[model samples]
Target: MHGRCISCRFFANDPALIEATFPGLNVLSSAYGSVRSDAGICSRHEFFLSSWQRCRDFESGDNEGKDALLPVEKKLIGYSIGFGAVLLGILVWISYTFFPTGH
Candidate 1:
C-alpha cells in the first residue's frame, strides 16, 4: 500500500485547478477537460489516476496539513461571489418592480 495520490504535488484532482495550472490546454485539446471525477494527472509520471489511488513515490507537495486554496481558485471564488452579488441585485430590482412590499 502507498500514500494517497491527492497528497502528491504532481496530482491535480480538480479539473479547474488542472486547467488553471496548464493554461490553454483546453484550447489545445478539449479532451483534456473530460477526465473522470476525482481523477487527476500525475505530471511526474505523465498519467491520470484517481485521487484515492496510491503511489510508492509519494511525496508531500509542501502543503502538509494545510488546506490552502490555490491563487487561481481564490480568484475564481471571488469572481463567483461578485457574480452572485450582481445577480442578487438584479433579482431584487425585478422583484421591487413587479411586486411591491407596501400596498
Candidate 2:
C-alpha cells in the first residue's frame, strides 16, 4: 500500500490547502489526491497519522464538510488558555483556604 487509499484519513480532500502545505505531493492526480470526499479517519486518531499516509477506516467528510485539520497555532492557543484557567483555579482555591474572607 502506497498509503494512498481513499479510505485513508491522511487523504487530503481540500486540493488548494493540501497543495499549498505539501507542495511535493500531487494534490490533484495521485491516488491520495484530494477527492473532496467526506471520508476520513476518525477525529480522535486523525492527529496521530503522518500527513503523507491515509487511514484504513476513513469515513466520509466531517459534519461541517470541512477538512479536519487544525492549525498548530490554534491548538497551542487553546492549550495555553486551558492551562491558564487551571492554574488560576488552583490559586483561587489556595487563597480561599489560607485566608478566609471573615478573617
Candidate 3:
C-alpha cells in the first residue's frame, strides 16, 4: 500500500504551488467520495496521488490542503454589491429629477 501511494513525490504546504504543478486536479474529497478508513487511500487521495504521480512525506505535514472560499459567500457578496450599486444609481437619478437646478 505504501509503495502504491508512494508513486508520486510532490507535496507542499502551499496549495497555489501544488495547483500550478497539477492543473485540473480536484481535491481528495471532491474526486473521491468520503475518507472512511485510516489505512487505505480514499478517492481524493488516490486522485491526487495518481494525477500528480508523487507522494508526500507524512512525517513532514507539508501537504496541507488549501482553504477555499465558500461559493455561497462569494455569491452573497456579489449580490449585495450589485444590489447596492443599482440602488445608489436609482437614488441619484431620483434626486436629480426631483431637485430643481438653480438657473
Candidate 4:
C-alpha cells in the first residue's frame, strides 16, 4: 500500500467487521488492496494496501503532502508551463520582427 490506512478517512481499525457487513462497499478490486497485515479498510474506495506501497485513495492527510502531484503529473505540468512560456516568447519575437516597435 502507498499510504497508511491509519490516516485515511474511510479507514476502519477493523475491516473484517465492516467488510463482512457491507459487501461491495469496499472491494479490494480497485487500487490494489492492502496486505493482510493492514486490517483497516479504506471505506471510501474500498481499498487496502501496505502503507508503504502506493496510496491513491488515502485521504485526510496533510494537505501539502496529500495534494502534491505525482512525478508524472508534475512533469506534465512543468511541460505545459514551459511550453506556454516558450510560445509567449515566440509571439513576442514575431511581433518585434514583423511589427514595428513604437520605441
lDDT against the true structure, per candidate, is 0.76, 0.52, 0.45, 0.61
User: Model 3: per-residue lDDT, tens digit, 54-103?
Assistant: 34343333333435768998899999999999999998888788874831
| Ranking of all predicted structures according to lDDT, beginning with the best and ending with the worst | 1, 4, 2, 3
CA lDDT of 5 in candidate 4?
57
Show where candidate 2 strays beyond 4 Å.
1-70, 101-103
Which ten contiguous residues of candidate 2 have the minimum total lDDT? 33-42
Clashing residue pairs for model 2: 8-54, 8-55, 9-55, 38-60, 38-61, 39-59, 39-60, 39-61, 40-59
**Candidate 1 Cα RMSD (Å):** 5.8
Top candidate by lDDT: 1
Worst 10 residues of 4 by lDDT: 28-37
lDDT of 2: 0.52
Q: What is the lDDT of candidate 4?
A: 0.61
For every model shown, what is its TM-score relative to the native structure? 0.48, 0.30, 0.33, 0.34
Residue ranges of candidate 3 with Cα displaced over 4 Å: 1-66
Per-residue C-alpha lDDT of model 2 across residues 30-60, encoded as one tens digit per residue: 4244453433333535342334455555554
Tens digit per residue, CA lDDT, model 1, 13-92: 66776677667877866434544566778988988677787778888775345678889999999999999999999988
Ten-residue region with minimum lDDT total, candidate 3: 30-39
Between the candidate structures 1 and 3, which one is better when assessed by lDDT?
Answer: 1
Q: Could you tell which candidate, 1 or 3, scores higher by TM-score?
A: 1
